[model samples]
Target: MVLKTAIFFVISIAAFAVMFTTMAPLTGFLSYHDVPRIVKDNNEETNWFALTESLLWDIFLVLLFIVQHSMMATPTWRGLIYNLGLVVVERSFYIAATAWALQYIMQSWLVIPDYPLWIIDTSQSTPWWWFFTLIHVMAWIIIYGATFTMDLPELLGLKQCLYRDTAWEFALICTICLTARFTNKGIQ
Candidate 1:
């Protein structure tokens, strides 16, 4: 039991690390040197094969991610894991696999030159831009905050090992608080 809990905790932390690394660009909080930004200036010069090969590799990564994620969600896969005595860390395994796939995609993403999609010039210092940026950041904050209202341990596959039945009551209270907080934010 101790080993299971420790493994789950470590995997959960790793999952969060990967998730935050992927999401930090959207929140303007991370500027990792090796991590590719989802939205970047398309004027930089890149190797021709880099674009094509990277794009193909990215597609393959996405397919792998989809297969791993969907397959693990199926009953048959769960049964297999159960039969294999990996039921306890099944969700953690899924999370870690998905995170690895995502990290691969992010790391290998190609920056296409001369292919501007949507470039918001932050240098202009427009009030509306800042306002919308604030709203965007707040929206993400609210979304993450709302997750506290749910069965997070179960969602993370730690429910059976770490959480008690009473946690549901706390979840419900958090839901009410989330709703109130959102309502208050919306009003202001």
Candidate 2:
């Protein structure tokens, strides 16, 4: 059991790392410079900082997950969902803090001389991109919640191994949905 767990842990980390690293670069490749410049021009420096903070938090959480899984062997889906919840909470902090900081920066810097505060609002009516971002975030919450809930019964019953290959396959589908929603593109 220990060896199997160890193998699974190693494989999971490697797979996720490779996928994220590859996709991040690939996605950035198309709009690499433009993305940063847009953040700088349209958003405040603090907005950029929030993005960095969120990424750092994600890295920290990944490391936490690896350590916890390897040492504690938290195999149940409930545990995984709890960890995901932490990630979401951390991300929420990043988003809220970034939004607040951006508002302050805009108010003080007056970066766009002509564009008044009323013209650019960050509320729900903001933009489709913003709405989509929120939707994607909410989707994760639902995924984690359902996965966790389903696993609790399984764990209690000890009916099957907690995270079988099928769990990963399901996760992939959820990830695909998340990415498509975030990009405002339908699943292909």
Candidate 3:
């Protein structure tokens, strides 16, 4: 039992780290200057220190993931689908909530330069809105596919859906995406 717990914890951490390493840019952690400013002119250069910060942040995220994942065993396909639906709902909520918050921040702060907040301007061809929408749609599709094929454990009760391992992993990935939006630099 103890060993299972440890193994789960380690697996969760690894999962979180891998997710964060890729999703940071989608959240808004990077800026135009971090690479080449092709859109808004108020571009700021990338900070090298952010690399170190990202590493540390990933570490912390993984630790949290370990704790969360270790709480339950692997979920079956039905459970995974249920968890995926939950993720869709959760991501929808997050997208709406964060957009609202960004609007509030822009309104409240005077003399606010064109800086990347919760929203990031990736290119001149389209607004961040398009990119975010694309990402959300793609994520939903991937999650749905993963869930549809899962063969959930028979022991899992409907009421225990929230406690499934996949749900926690999905939630953690969303959180990591949120954090990465605010901290990532340009693609290295």
Candidate 4:
């Protein structure tokens, strides 16, 4: 029992660390990563094959994340882990998988040769550029604010195992998970 608890903490910490670190580049908050390297580059050179390959790779990475998030969140998947006598650390496993997916996407994401579908102004001189930057930052604020409405430790797979450390029992309460909302384009 103690071993399982210890394992849960390690996994939770590692997974959360990976996910947290991976998010910056994926969300365009970092300017030095692979995704940013493509967008900010001014060169318009197009190697058709390389661009196609890069795009396919990116699509695969996105699909990988989407599938992992969707499937692992299912009741069936949770029940499988629960029935295997692993119910206590179920959320940790899910978080670990999510971290792996996000890490893989962030690391292996190739720069599309003919990329940056839309021109982005990184300069701070223009009003429109600043407005767009504010909008992006606002999106991040809104997302984090919404997430903080939940039990953050539990949501991040920490509180569940940590509950055993103390006498306190952890329960899934005061949490809102935004999932499965779809519009015309695709799942968002």
Candidates by lDDT, descending order:
4, 1, 3, 2
Off by over 4 Å in 2: 1-61, 74-125, 141-145, 148-151, 156-188
Query: Per-prediction count of colliding residue pairs?
Result: 0, 0, 12, 0
lDDT of model 3, residue 117: 40
Identify the superior model by TM-score, candidate 2 or candidate 3: 3
Listed in order, each prediction's TM-score against the native is 0.60, 0.22, 0.27, 0.67
What do the candidate models score in CA lDDT, each in turn? 0.64, 0.42, 0.43, 0.70
lDDT tens per residue, model 2, 1-188: 55654554454444334433443343333222212112236444445555556557646645554554444333453466457643212222222333333333323331222322233333435575576556655765685467576744232222122344347457658888789787855655
> Top lDDT: which candidate number?
4
Give candidate 1 regions above 4 Å deviation. Answer: 1-54, 163-188
Task: Tell me which of candidates 1 and 2 scores higher on lDDT.
Answer: 1
Displacement of residue 99 (Cα, Å) in model 1 is 1.9
Candidate 2 similarity to native, TM-score: 0.22
Q: Which prediction has the highest TM-score against the true structure?
A: 4
Error of 3 at 158 (Å): 1.0
Clashing pairs in 1: none
The digit string of per-residue lDDT tens for model 1 on 112-150 reads 533444455554557756776777767778988898899
Ten-residue stretch with the least lDDT total in model 4:
170-179
lDDT of 4 by residue, 35-68 (tens): 3333434575557787788888889988998999
List ranges where model 4 is wrong by over 4 Å. 29-47, 113-115, 122-125, 164-188
